[model samples]
Target: MRAGIIGLALAGAAVPVTVAAPQATTVPVPPAKAPFTFQEVMVPMRDGAKLQTVILRPTGKTGPLPILLQRTPYGVPQSAPSQVPDSYKALMKDGYIFVYQSMRGRFKSDGSFTFSTAVHPDDPKAVDEATDAYDTIDWLVKNVADNNGKVGMWGVSYPGFAAAVALADPHPALKAVSPQAAWVDYWMNDDLHRYGAMRLSYATDWLYMLQHDKAQDSTFEYDQYDTYDWFLRQTPVAKIDQDYFKGSIPMFTAMLDHSNDDAFWKKQDWLGALKKTTVPTLNVAGFWDQEDPWGSWQIYYKQEQNDPDHLNQIVAGPWNHGGWHGRGDTMGRIPIGTDSGIQFQQQIEAPFFAYWLHGKGKRPDFEARMFESGSFVWKSYKHWPPRGAVEKSLYLHVDGTVSFDRPDAGEACRSYISDPDNPVPFRPRPISPTYPIPDWRLWEFGDQRFVGGRPDVLSYKSAPLEHDLTVTGELAATLMASTSGTDSDFVVKLIDVYPDNYEQLREKPELGDYGRSLNGYQLPVAMEVRRGRFLESAEVPHALTPNKVIAWNVPLRSHDHVFKKGHRIMVQVQSSWFPVIDRNPQKFVPNIYRARPEDFVTARQRVCAGSKITLPVMAE
Candidate 1:
């Protein structure tokens, strides 16, 4: 599936107040008997910026309650809900005041909106997200009626980013923070770009709507429904500003001018600023999150670098961006076997906040908790990569098969001619806008059969496993490859190929269509694209020696999946992922965004016999 970068308005949950092992805990937050009242507040920041905030307080007056703050760039809900959303029902019984606020530049808030900004450690006067969160917490503890001074913050996607900002020099009252599917570094692996390939579809459209009218919502309108055609018509990134934006939007110009990971992008590397963690942090993630998926794990690892308190824990599940809000039970065309969404909300999230804010429970025992797909099992561990995990390489063979054994010396290399005019589609044709449609986000799970046999694509699938093959951590694709042109892009996808005669499970609750027969289903476990030029240096550019094989190391992020018996492992290599990523001209150009139409050229690509994908095999 295509990874998206949008941060949506989602629910919040914390670990339940229980000492029972995670899997053994499942009690939901019993319905609240105390009445609650919602109040609007324009909280003044340290810089005097008044943020529009809504405070939901329990009227039980059962002594003062802790405050749970969720700062978001998306508008705050205008009215309080009659019932807690099912996604957050588990947190309802804890009885803490819920504070929701819109960040600066969003509705009713007083500043300009920024997609992402670097943490300014050098400047004391810098007014970034960290400072905003600190100010919000300070104000809430000071003015709110809540007698308990403790506070906890959590949010999904963009708001998840807001939750992360609270960890840096957190306010004295802030105890726990969860940044789920948060956007961290834009250039590295978040939404905007992957490695150096521009996420053309997401970047342009997102910026256009966001920057068009800061005072109100302004989404870009397409002349036709098929966004694939809409983006394909806009060749070369330079034409976009002149034809549509006319250079009015600053973000658009910056995307083209700052094509490389230069200072502009470096300033957007928020994760690099995470030198330490001052508060207990719960970094949540989704294995299939289309947006901001990479940031959560990156932030978690960085915080762990100096975590003496052992306060950092991670929970990654098989869901898309913000999918844990409710849909973690099923994704794409498969049911994840358990109500993972409810489990995380009740067993993990509700308890995490309850203990920190109210001192009602103990910290979760596991350092890492994940929902292992395929097996439909939930796993908790003392350490990530589980303890005895070993690295293994699956070599590519000329016969279109992949295996752990080394390829024979006589094994020939495979070659494919890539044409810029007809680059392989990232998904099936007629792709639509990234928003306003369900299919837009589900594209990540589109049937691979559509592009598996294309001429420009090279595939290597492993034989059906006789036993379960479980991969628990990160993975990388190491391809000894070269292209006929000076520049190119390489997309490597790690796929789970199900066997024939597969059928849905009837043991658990029926997933309806999601539980449909899985015959021939090709699930994408992990995939990432690398811009060849960036291979030399993400900040510097260098063209490849024509037809000279060079190593391209592409990390497929982190995943936890079990390739069950009879299932096959597959790796699909192609140059273009369509509007998901901008096309690489294959010809060297000082600035790819400015390349002319004629600059596009055909290139012959080769994956040498030594090519292999390195996978983390967890010891049973």
Candidate 2:
């Protein structure tokens, strides 16, 4: 059950689940020296599905111990220390019973596992994750050997998503909850489509892994080294299943069947279901969390709506998906200026669980703890966006310069031809899968210089900043644009353009070779894409009138970063983010999944000069 089986095989590829196993070091707590024991038990649900559960307890307890639960689909952690690695010494040192369980239809558990839905409060007999959690807690508080009634939940990625939804309606004993880089909505945020653009590489590979075999752990095998080329050769989208999947992953079919964000996905919005709950929760995120960066923000915002007790708190760091658990001080080539992961784990995460479960510390101020990206500093806020934040719009000029001033009355639209045949690569030439386990995790940090100069991409940058310009909170682009094709895709990237002498002036050491020069590194802070057909309504599709200018609003996920003096704020526009996102085809099609090769055509797109991006800039 070692979570090291992270990328338990999906169809054929090894898309490892994001939970990282801790090392084998132990903290210096005397109570942790108590004898340890493990037990495998089946906890039954209201609907009679017995979940496979593992309970690790310190038999030599000095007193009553709290129950710490981790629920996952990537099999349970090993009964040995693999289940309780050295990283856990911090929490284990505090003295508590650790519980790991396999969700239904996973491993030896009794029921079917469907990744599509969360929970339906409307149904009296619904047996979703929330109910499963409720039932499990109820059973443990009564049947488990421990005496303390308090329980805490934590997980990363899918297990993280499990931890999140479980708290939608938590039991009384459920005290503190932490959902780290957990997935929320499939359509609007997280692993699949981003704002309706299909993440071809991720979804195709993940679905294949899930639907192919019921084994506990396995990895997908690809005949070629580069997936970008592999998926290209298997274009037309429909052939993915026809060629290898053979309709094996019904989830894949279900994804394409829903052309829009209809009820199928609406019911899966985990954040939308938090209106009534008031559990003291800690939502952890990574500014570079390519997988679920948008999820934690959306979850935190929705939780803030009714958090009168101020129990909901968020921690957005410079880490990647579960990066706080991976490396503490750095992400990609960017140093956090501190051992942030260690800081969060020991200072933030451990103490958080301790305060709620053991009643050892004072309640937090409920402020958002954020790692300022550009400046490489950690700043705590009484509230996110830090109060007096200003909304500034950087207008797109005909001259390709992004400025704070409006366009000067001229035909200032920037036009680019979108060719599906030669779509812009999301990464370098040989793009690998999203998970090479460790290395693939850092791809989101790849330098923007890869696609910066592409003909299909339109880039707009402002003059060098004379002072530190820090942006916090939400990011969005308002565009007046048109396309020659009836349907298209629009991608907007917000970047931080370092000074040409960036490397020379800086003294920090570089981390990895992402294949780019640091002299003038173009680092992307945030980005997103909107499928043209869904511009009107995510649940509906409409064709555009060729050459007619219309409004396209693209939401670039929120962030906290400072653009230092001499740096430039840039924006890049394109119609496709290949392989990562399927080709738009640039033509109208009710279901892009079934579109023929003929439906794929070249289209001329235009972004008028009046268009501008709104940045959430905080007043220093």
Candidate 3:
């Protein structure tokens, strides 16, 4: 847990889940005979609280090396790994004193822990993640022996947030940081919620895991194999705690209390803290990142605003939450043609730190390095969305076809009945827990055909492309339609449809029973949901006018992908995405969280002919 999948320690991305009873332990005992020697110490914070820190120095090396620090709410190690973990091998080869520390009120660390990264740097009395990170670096550079004064920080997910927070008020010794798959704003597009609709499974599972115990990460045990069934069986959002959690998870309760983007959620915004770029940053993201995908881009752009020194750079690949830590040659059914993970680690990440922390290599010159899927090649750009990319409209036709040209005169719209009682599953059923379920990580890349034909889903596809079409920037869907319900959730997905006669992949022993053929596979490039209530303004949400057409803008985020020749570009519009996205209830209520079971009802959803999905197409 210390050296690998450390983000899983707190956020539960790919961590192994122990189905047995949950137990509480003060400190985690690390494996014996690790390549690095482990030493535990209490690092004093500015607020007079002590944090549990573990320092791991290379076993045989003795020369002075810069400190590579990672602060996490996840538990720190009592001992080091028996060998260099895959996640650390690339960086370890460069040599450094690795340090891991449990955040305040986590494990043996003193002081209470608030799961928010919001920090107030102006007030001396305010101590948050930023302050804690600052204090920890101050203590490490001054107290920890080894003779090196420089420090660098890197982490994935929550730890990534901590890495970004350090930039608010960085320590003098801190030189570089990488906030991979980090969360900049929780209320907008991160873990808990997307727009205004809650991410039911992730929010429910992660809250129970992170807050259930201060000493260890816990997973909620389910009686049913399919979490989709398990979640649907629960009461409304307001009664979830009463029915199961029993107030054990305070974060869930707080989320329900703040159903809207009000002050409670607004206080957690960290963009203000990062108004200026202080430390050299490598903001990493994944085009297919299921958790915390939006943050890395948000951070990169925020830093670019005032970065006259150009210390900011980004690397986005076809990775899941922490997929870059593993072998990234293949993602689900698609072969990336290159080991993107290693490329990022050895070429980009390692070099960035080498230049900034150890002064060993030249600084990265490019502003963005992205892995363009479909083409399965690495792309370098001086600016993201590359200067040559242009926004083009892909219109939806009532005949169930999509085209770059405007739709001819025909039926006004296509309709579907979205029933909350039988919501559309985000993935094929027999769905397992969000964490530990190997399939959970690859769900984003799963074939959309599973739900494409459902009565609740409306699918439209363009004819086979004659040439490779590359989309390299932000994507959005402008839906001009109406709903029978006063409140609705519009889910838009940009998909890549493989040709019926697509070339089949060679059967590898590692693939086992999974299909090797890519024929007719519907891979989602980008998908997002926007609630009708918050369409106008998130702060003042009101009931929508029933049966009245209105424009709904659904942001599909950004991606660097190509629709190869003969492959069709598809767009799928739906209402509910099952437990992945909480049921909208359809009928508007003052607080959807408090809506009764009766609030759930069937609503007619439509996609008008004029509706179009704007893609940032790279100019040929």
In order, what is each prediction's RMSD in angstroms? 10.4, 9.6, 9.9
Cα lDDT over the full model 2 = 0.81
- Higher-ranked by TM-score: 2 or 3: 3
The per-candidate count of clashes, in order, stands at 18, 15, 1
lDDT (Cα, tens digit) per residue for candidate 3, span 1-620: 57667755667655565786578767977666558888999999888999999999987767778999998887887677778988777778778899999998889999766687678978999899989998999889888877389999999998899898899898889899999989878889999999978999999888888888888888888888888888887758766788888888888998888899998888899888786787899999988888898998999999999998998988998888888888799878788788989888888888888888778877689999888888888899998768899889999998889998897776588899999889899998888897766788889989888886688899999999999999998889999889999999999998999998787455553554336567788999899999999998899898999888889998888788889999999999999998998898999998888889998989998888789999899867
Colliding residue pairs in candidate 3: 34-81
lDDT of 1 by residue, 397-479 (tens): 99999999999987777999988888677777787777666776766765687898799999899998989888888889899
- CA lDDT of each candidate? 0.83, 0.81, 0.87
Off by over 4 Å in 2: 1-36, 58-61, 82-86, 505-517
Error of 3 at 368 (Å): 0.5
* Candidate 1's TM-score: 0.91
| Candidate 2 residue lDDT tens string, 73-122 | 77885554534565576776678888899987778888766785567877
Ranking by TM-score: 3, 1, 2
Per-residue lDDT of 146 in model 2: 55
TM-scores, in order shown?
0.91, 0.90, 0.92
